[model samples]
Target: MTDVAIIDYGMGNLRSVAKAIEHVAEGRAVTVTADPAVVRAAGRVVFPGQGAMPDCMRELDARGLRRAVLDAAHEKPFLGICIGQQMLFAHSAEGDVPGLGILPGEVVRFDDARMVAADGSRLKVPHMGWNEVWQAGPHPLWEGIEDGARFYFVHSYYVAPQEAGLTAAHTDYGVRFTSAVARANIFAAQFHPEKSAAAGLRLLSNFIRWAP
Candidate 1:
């Protein structure tokens, strides 16, 4: 059986993500781990993270699993969620922290403009709620999920990949931002699947069944 490793780097909503993955794993071996050896040996890797960039990076490095994550990203089907996805970029405006640089881009904060809807009410920062995600490209991870599907989001910042083609899906707040991305063996999302309900579950299912 192919083993799925949900990296426990001490950040992310590990329990929720692990439970969600386990719920859909069917017969696969799913492990919530911080061990480099376990991560290296897994057939697939799920990288989920929350909280600030600096702390997340600190924990990942403190645990000495940075190299393991990089290796997994290169050698296996890797799924990066939220801060896990943000950390894949070259840099982040959040605390000016540097990222893994696996994907060419920088993470940026939503500008401090006083955004207002046509109804004239102030739009909130940390964009927490269900928002529509428009597909920017096609990938196996998006299977069965329709374009313009609503996914749950909770963040004050978003990724801005240098390569426009890297964006797999986008969402609009005051501005349009990349909500999901894909390349080679990596597919990542800025939303929390465990909190996203049905469409989120479907996306997780697709990830488990994804061959590439």
Candidate 2:
């Protein structure tokens, strides 16, 4: 079987994600591909992306990866990171752009007004740093990871699912937001697990072995 396929649509540097998966995939064949066929044929799919929502959507379609992504999300174990996670929703406030609608939700930016720490310090918009992630519940992908482990984040926007049950984990910066989501065979994270160090590696390893 094609063990893992990391979708490449030219959004961001996908090499880190590829290397991280390679570290955990054992001898599993990991392919970084832009081909729709490879993505559809893979046993597991990791959709990692960054940048603005509108551009991401356009690039996805332009590269002819739209249908393949949707298919993998429905048929196999799927993992989405950063904008990859946001694109799974119905819409995004980033540019009033529509998404794949695989999940019922919208991606919204962190409020500028609420960008303050408890001591009244200014919090940055990108939220670029390590933040504590509170696990919403147990899942196979979270195996060997603590509930409040810190993960690296580098984005200004976060997703708001229509259903609360879809939240796999949450984190607080300006306000609490869905940092990770899971339903059926899909699990997505707003944080960049590839850059999150040991805890991140553990999560990736779990995903490699996750059968659901």
Candidate 3:
């Protein structure tokens, strides 16, 4: 069985993600660890988070998980979720803070001024709730997932990759933005798969089956 490690850096929804992975893998070994040694030994890594960009970066740095994660991404399969995905970029407008710089891009907030609201009120910053994901690209990470499938999204900022072909999926708020991304062995989703229901489970399963 494949051993998967969900990096526990004190900010992610770690338990739910681990449970969801267990549900999909059945008998596979899934462990949530804050230790860099365990993360390095795992066959796969899932970087999950539900917090601010700046705080996430600080926690990873303070805990020394940043280098471990980057090393794993280069050699093994790495899955990042929510704020986890945002950290893969170069920087974020949220705190004007630098990211892990795994992928060449920056995270930016959704501008409500450009959107036409029904009540004439500005669209909320944190775009919570279910939204349809329009998948693009042919990466193994999205192999079984279909286009227009709804995924649970809860974020104010979205990733804009330097390479357009790296965009695996997109979602619309005030404007369309990249919701999923894949480059080589690294994969990430702006939406929360653990909170996305069946479609989300299928995505997780696909990740489990994906071989680096």
Candidate achieving the largest lDDT: 2
Error of 3 at 208 (Å): 0.6
Off by over 4 Å in 3: 117-122
Q: Give candidate 1 misplaced runs (Cα > 4 Å).
A: none
lDDT (Cα, 0-100) at 128 in candidate 3 = 87
With a 3 Å backbone cut-off (N, CA, C), the pairs that clash in candidate 3 are none
What is the clash count of model 2? 0
User: Candidate 2: RMSD over Cα atoms?
Assistant: 0.7
In every candidate, how many clashes are there?
0, 0, 0
Better structure of 1 and 2 per TM-score: 2
Candidates, ranked, TM-score? 2, 1, 3
Error of 2 at 206 (Å): 0.4
Estimated TM-score for each candidate: 0.96, 0.99, 0.94
Q: What local distance difference test score does each model get?
A: 0.91, 0.95, 0.88
List, residue by residue over 1-212, the lDDT tens digit for candidate 3: 33999998889668889899999987889999998999999989999898888899999999989889989888898999999899988999988999988899989988777764556667777898998899886777666777798999888889999999879888877788999999889889999999889989988998898886
Ten-residue stretch with the least lDDT total in model 1: 112-121
RMSD in Å for all candidates: 1.2, 0.7, 1.7
